[model samples]
Every structure is written in C-alpha cells, then in structure tokens.
Target: MADKQDKSQTKPTSLQATIAGGFAGLLCIAPLDVVKINMQLQTNRLEGLKWAKRGIVHQTKGIYKEFGARGFWRGNASAQWLYLFYGGSQFFAYDQIKRALAKTDLSSESKHFISGAVAGTFATVTTYPFDILRTRFAAQSKDRVYTSVLDGFQKMAKAEGFRGLYTGLAPSIVSILPQAGLMFVGYEALAPVFKELNLPFGAGDFLAGAVASGAAKTAVFPLDLIRKRLQVQGPARSKLAYGAIPEYKRNMFAAGRAILQNEGPRGLYRGLVIGVLKAAPTASLYFWFNARALEILVQNEIFA
Candidate 1:
C-alpha cells in the first residue's frame, strides 16, 4: 500500500497536473483576491482592525455598487498571468526536482521542503512583476492607474526602470520561501492519510491540502500583507500630500512597525480572514485538480 501510494504521488505531480492546478487556482482565487487587496488597503478607520467591520459581504457589495460585477474581477488580467505561471511552475519544479533528488541520500521531508522552496522561488522570481501589477489593479479604488496590463508594465518600466515591477520582491521572496516550503511539504506529507480513507475523487487530498495551506497562509499572513502594501506603495506615496513620506513601504520592517503603531496589532492581520477563506478552498482545489489531471494523463499514458 505504501509503495502504491508513492507511485501514485509520483505520477500525479506532472506538468499536466501543474497546468490544471494553475487553472483551478485562478478560478477559485481571483474574486477573493480583489476583496483582500481592498481590505488590506483600507485606511479610514482610526482604531482596531477596520477590516473587522468590512466583512466579505460588505466588501463585495461595495465593489459591486462601485464597479459592478466586473469589479469582483478587477485584476483578473494580471491574475491570469500570475496564477498560470505561479501555479504551473511551482509544481513543475517541486515535482521534477524532488524526483531528481530521490536518488540522493536526503530524507523525504527535507526533499519535499527543499523542492517546494526552490520551485516557489523560481516561479515567483520569474513572474513576480505580474503579481505586482495584479495587486496594483486590485488595491486601488479611484483615479485609476494603468489602463491595462501593457500600460502597467510600460509605466513601471518608465517610472522605476525594470526594477519598478519588482517593488516588494525582496520581502516577498523572504516571506514566500518558508510559506511555500511549509504548504507543499505539509500537504504532500498529509495527503496519504486521505488515500487510506478511500475518499472519492481524491476529496481527502483536497481536505489535507486545505488544512495544511490554511495553516501556512495564516503563519505568513502578515508577510503577505506587507508584500501587498509594498507593491502599492508607489501609487499611495505618489498621491500623498507634499512633504509626506512618499516611500513608507520602502522597508518591510518599518512598514510593519507603522502598521502596528497606526492600526494596532490587528493591522498586521488585515484581510487575514478573507485570506484564509480564499486560501483553503484555493489550495484544496489546486491539489485536487492537479492530482486528477495527472491521473487522467497517466491513465492515457501521456507521460509514461
């Protein structure tokens, strides 16, 4: 049974599975992403956890009222690029690298963790600019910036050179390395219990992934918030009153401190609830579809 399980696991983490995961993640995560960006950028409240007041329902309604149904999908263009690349590349690296390392003397857990971190960093570094653009499109409300994806890229290049697209990349890499390592390693490790239960259609794998990813996402939520804030700092700072510190997000440590001082401890947790809700389902669907897609591909001898 253990050997069978190992074979199944090896088969499922394929390029086909990676592509399916990307599509599934995009569908599940795009709407919640917009809401999360909005909540994170909320600055009107003078006290504890302003996001506590603006629940998902409230944010959804406001976005609908202001931008209509399309509002829910504001940054989908960049999100599509981001999700496709991020989702596919992450699993691809994790799958291939781990398989290659299986010949070595490394323990399984170390292999899983290392592969996940490597894949995540490669994917993130390769496609990070798209994420910045997606966050920018999702975070802003009025006086629109960057009419389109091309325009966003052009603006970033013109304003801050190629580096403009990578505003918060350092902190993001720092945050994501551990988060990705934890999420994938934990999910892969826990997934077999579901197989033992014989959950239909790999439902148990989905559940395991959700639980693992939820935990990882929570642990890294503050870093995620800081990354988002840094991504949008340019526009926020640019519009600031004259003499205002136009680069508040220049330093992740300082930005974190500012959030603590201004918005209190809960400020670091902005959009955390929504992030968890979004992450659980998204991660579940991601793993589930990746497995299912690989199963199909294997059954057809596509990669055999």
Candidate 2:
C-alpha cells in the first residue's frame, strides 16, 4: 500500500501538468482582464467602481447585442501566448527555486516568499513584452483598430521608438517583488494547515492562493496602476513626447512624478477593484489546478 501510494502521488506532480494548470488558469481570467483595462482607460465622466460597473454593463450589453457573448473573449488568442510564456515561466522558476531552497534550513515561509519573488521578477523580465502586447490586445475594441499583436508592436515602435516596448517596465518590476513574496509565503503557510486538517488540496490551495494573491495585489496595486498607465498611455500624451525617445528616459520615479502631476495620486491606483477581481480568480484557479496536477503527477510516478 505504501508503494502504491507513492506511485499514485508521483502521477500528478509532473512538470507538464503544473505548466498546463498554470496556462489554464491564466486563460480563465482573460475576459476579466479585458474589462478591467477598459475601466482603467475610460476617459469619460465615469470613474472608480462606478466606471467599472458601468464598463462591465456596457461590455456585456455590447457582447450580447453584437457578438452574442463571444465578444468578451476578444483577446484570448493573444492571451494564450502571454499565459504560456509568463505563466509557464513563473511556475517553472517558482518550483525550481523552491526546490533549491528546500535543501537549506530556512523556514518554509522564508523560502517560499523569496523564491516567489525571484521567480516573478525573472518571469517578468523575460515576458514583459508579451504582457504589454496582451494588455494592448485586451484594451482594443471589436472595431479592430490595431489588427494584431505584430501590428501593435510595429505601430508602437514606429510611433514611439524601440523604448515603447518597455513603456511601463519600472513600476511593473517593483510591484512584482512584494506581490509575489506575499503570495508564496501565504501559500506555504496555509498548505500545511490544510494538510493537517485533512482537507482536499485543491480547496485548500485555492483558498490560500486567493488570500495571498489578494493581499499581495492590494499591497502593490499602486505601482501596478502606474505601470499600466505608462504602458497604455500614448507617447503623444506622455512627458516623453519630445518627438525623440531618449536613452536616459528609463527613470520610473521621474515618470511617476509626471503621472502624479498630470493625473493625481488617485490615478496611480486606477482600476484596483478590477485588478483584485481578476487576480482572485486567476490565482485561485492556478493554485487549484496546479495542486491537483501535482497530485496526479505524483500518483503517476512521474515526479516522486
């Protein structure tokens, strides 16, 4: 029975299973992200929860009226690539880092937090462009102004120069550290408690992951807002609108100052509610699926 149990545990822990679960979770929240971005970029009188609620209503109305509910998934195709690279790399790096840290005497919480931060930072660096692209796609309307990701990239490059690809990189990187640290730390702290209580891993993982994601996202939401504003704002509208992109224009503080002056501190946290809404489901699904996948892999004798 011990041998059989070991083989069963091994079945769900394969690397591929974990990756697939991550991707699936990301895909699940693509529509919510689209709605969230639309709310963020609204220029009319609507603002905050009022704006977000209205936006969701408008989007739902439009989808029902026009595309028959399928419109909500407008950017899903591009999002798949975003998820594949960003989600896969994040989990892959996170798992690897955790494994390495497990060899040390550090507390599980410490290892999990540090490993998550490192993994998030590394994944962000590698896949920031795809993230930018995903946002662009999500922010588009059914009218199809940009056409495709390549077109958006080309237009951004031509309009703003090569630097456009990394418009919001600074705040994005800063936000990742705390957000990811809290997430993993929370997950690690809760996992054992769940096990002790003899609950299913999926339920425990989702609840733990959701709480962790919400906390982390809330903590760093201001920075995330700044990053999104920078990424989505046009070059013609930014302080960098000097007709020529400068090599020394990579200062996040300066950019933040400009944003504050132009849009106020409240602008720094635009769409926070939507962000939390999107993140909760995304993170919950990821941990739930990933835990289940890991269980399956462990059971299959794939990663014992």
Candidate 3:
C-alpha cells in the first residue's frame, strides 16, 4: 500500500517538473529568438562578425531607444500562444510517433528521425497560421504594430485573403523534414554518451537535446532563409506568387540565386549563430524536462 501511494505521488511530481522545464526553456530562449529574427531581417551591407556585431548593436539600440529593455520582448504575449501551440504540438506528436515506432523493428536512429519529421509536419500543418502571425508580430517595428494576435490574423486575412496565413507553407514544410530529422537523430545519439559519463538524467537529457537542435538547425538553415523571406514579404516578393508567366513557380529558385548573388554563399546561413545560441538551450531544457516528467508520471501510474 505504501509503495502504491509512493508510485501515485511520483507521476504528478514528474509531470509538474516536465511542464516547469519546458516553460523555463521557452522563457530562456525567447529573447534569443527576438535577436535571431532581427538578424535575419536586417538589410544592411555588413558581413561576418561585422554584420553580426552590427545586428546585435542595432537591436540593442533599437530596444533601448524604443521600449527600453522591455521592448526587446515586444511580441512575447502572442509568442506565448505561438510557442504553446507549436511547441506543445511538436512535443506531443514526437512522443506519440516515437511510441508507435517503438513497436516496429526499426533502428532507434531511424525511428527518431521518422518521429521527428512526423512531429514537425503534424505541428506545422495544424498551427501554421498562428506561426505566420507570430512572425509578423515579431517582425513589426515598435511604431507599426498589430494590437493583438487576433488583430494580426484578422488584418492579414482581410487584406491578403485566407491564403495569406499560409504564405510560406512550401518552404516551411520542406524545411521541417531535415530540421526535425537531424534534431532527433542528434539527440538520440548523444544521450547515451552523457549517460555513459554518469551525468544525472536531466542534465544528460538537456545536453543531448541542445546538440540535436543545433545539428538540426544547421542542416535546414537555408530552407529557413527561404521560408522567412516568403513569410515576411508580400505576394509579389514571395515564391508562392503564381501568375500566367509562372513567375511564382520560379521565384523560389530565383530567390536562391539572388541570395547567392547578392549576399554570397554565407547569406544562406544568416542568423545561424543566433539559431545555435537559441536552439541548444531551448531543446536541452525541453527534453530534459519532458523525459523527467514522463518518468515521474509513469512511475505514479498517471501515464499508465
């Protein structure tokens, strides 16, 4: 009876821990995400560290000049919902896919990759419009803004039509495949190493998760560039802009060439440093918390 009570108590504690970890992780990286998006949208002619340093400096100056330190987190309210839907869905889908794959004869790596891809695809398909709004809100200047998430959504829909909400669906979906696949593969591969080194489960999970996120982001960095451009720019500038000339069909390829021509090969990886900075800690914390939470829940039979 004592053992049963202990078990029952364990699950809730674990679940609480997991939820705590995930939210903590999200808060940690929110500022970094702001930095990353700013960097990606900068049109200045700086390069390498000069470009990076300028972006950071400019962002800091803008934040201080506008909303002080708080200005940097401008879209955070809407972002909370964005992350909740996107992050929650992705994590949930990942677990579900992984569990289903566990019954198969596939290798752990194969399972992880497939699970990640499926999770990404599922999450994107379900919550893409919110994603578009989040980007718009994040990319907005302090002077020009949407009053709220619903305001942004309604405005975009009214102005651009229903399809505006899915402006960058093609590159966004394609980008998810490799990004998610690499993230899971990297996480699964590195987890054992940390375990072998005798680190605690939470610490090991975070470290592995960070590495996986970095790897995944690096792999799909180019796709992200394309997607962001399409999302931020209106129909005329996007690759999705279709017409009698089939101009939109060629816009994607043309955009790739323009990036290379104007910004050089390195332009394809704009904001990569910020991406790594953000992804590593975010993923690490998310997985660490998630695993710990699940273990606790299962032990208490909350998940059984």
Candidate 4:
C-alpha cells in the first residue's frame, strides 16, 4: 500500500506541469497584480492621481469604474507569456540543478537556495523583456501606450534601444534570487508539516505555498517596487502615465535612494498588502495545479 501510494504521487517536478500551474496561477492573480503594480508605481511626486493610494478594494473598484472589467487584465498577455516561459525553464532548471546537487555535502536548505537562485537567474534573464512589458501595460491607466504585446516590444526596442527592454534587470535579478531561494526553502520546510496536520485535499500544498510565497515576496518587496518604478520611467512615463513620475536613471541603488529621499521607507513598500494577497493565493494555486497536473500526466504515462 505504501509503495502503491508513492507511485500515485508526482515524481519530482515536470516542466509541463510547472508551466500549466504558473499559467493557472497567473489567471487567478492578474487583477490583483495589475492593482499591485499601479500601487507600487504610485508616488507623492504625482498629485490628483491618488486613486491607487487606497486599499485593494477601493483601487479595484476604481479600476473597474474607470477602465471597466477588462481593465483588471490590462497586461495579461505579456504576463501569460512570462509565466509560460519562466515557469517551464525555472522549474526544469531547479529540478536538474537540485538533482545534480543532491550528491554534494551541502545542507538541504543551502541546496534548495542555490538551485532556486540559479534557476531564477536563468529564467528571469530569458523572460525579462516580457516582464517589462507586463509592468508597462499594467502601469498605464490614463493613456494607451502599446496596443499589444508585440507592439510594446517593438516600441520599446525602437524607442529606447536594447537597454529599454531590460530597464530593471539588475534589481529584478537581485530581488528574484533571494525570493526564489526563500520560496523553495519555505515551501519544502512547510509542506511536510502541513501534510502532517491532516488537512483537506490540496490544503497542505495550498497552505505551504501561501506561507512560502507571502514570506518570500514580502522579504524582497522593496526591490520589486523599485523594479516596477524603473520599468515605467522613460518617455512614456513622462507623458502618458497617469500621475507624476519620479525619474530613476541610475542603478537600483540609486532608485532605492531616490524613493527613500522623496517618499520615505514606506514608499519602498507601497503595494505590499496587495502584493502579498496576490502572491499567496497565486503560489497556492501554482503548487496545487502543478501537483494535480503531474499526477494526471504520470497516471496517463504522458511525460513520464
């Protein structure tokens, strides 16, 4: 019975399952993500556009009232592509790296951290352009900047050159490395404990993922806000963005310093609650869907 039960579970992580899970998670979190970006990008530099300064419910209602239902999913196309590519590559890399590291004498926490960081680096660099586009689309409330994802790419490349496509790459990488590492460490540590609690179906995975994601995201959220700020700060921001925009032309540190000087420390974490809200459930769904998809695939002898 024990052997049969083991066979019924997913054998490690599968790329297809990871991608499916990420896409599912994205669908669940897109609206909150849009609002989160808007809130993060909001600054005292801007007046008369304090809509995002309110709570999540208020901001959400404002989005709907102003831009209608579709407003909640402004950058969903870019986001979907991001999850598709990043999810597959990151999980595949993590699995391979973890397996390779398994023979080493490193501690389990160290191994998970290293594997997650490396995988996150690879995936983030590969899909970074999509991330910028997603932020751009999400941050744009007053004006229609890029009509579509392809158009956004073309415009970014044409207007700002190659650098535009990777505006906040440094900060993004820094933030993601620790976030990814912590997420894996937290989830791995919490999953067994949650399972031991005799939770309902998917509850263990969901709770483990939620706690992991919430903690990991909150830890590096300031850098995340800085990344989003830098992403939308070029010509488009100067002219078309909803409110006043503070320019951060230098590196991530400079951006952080600027935010600190202008808006204080709380400014660095403007959208923290919304971010936690989005990340927790999104990660919960990701883990649950990944497990379910892997089980289905394995049962069907699909991907092995």
TM-score leader: 4
TM-scores for all candidates? 0.87, 0.80, 0.81, 0.93
Candidate 1 residue-wise lDDT, 69-116, digit = tens: 887787789888888888887877877888888899998888888888
The parts of candidate 4 lying over 4 Å away from their true place are 1-6, 9-28
lDDT of each: 0.77, 0.68, 0.68, 0.83
Candidate 3 stretches with Cα past 4 Å from truth are: 1-28, 44-53, 235-251
Candidate 1 lowest-lDDT run of ten: 237-246
Residue range with the least summed lDDT across 10 consecutive positions in model 3:
239-248
User: Candidate 3 residues 1-304, lDDT tens each?
Assistant: 8886676555333234435434543544667777776666544332322323455666557545645677567567767776666666776677678778879999988999998898888878878887776666556654554678788777778877888888778888888988888888888899888878788545888889888888888888887876766666654232111111112232556666767777678877778888788888888877786676666656656635
TM-score of 3: 0.81
Model 4 residue 252 CA deviation (Å) reads 0.4
Better of 1 and 4 by TM-score: 4
Candidate 1 accuracy as lDDT: 0.77
Error of 4 at 242 (Å): 1.3
Model 1 stretches with alpha carbons more than 4 Å out: 1-25, 44-53, 235-246
Tell me the lDDT of model 1 at 263: 74
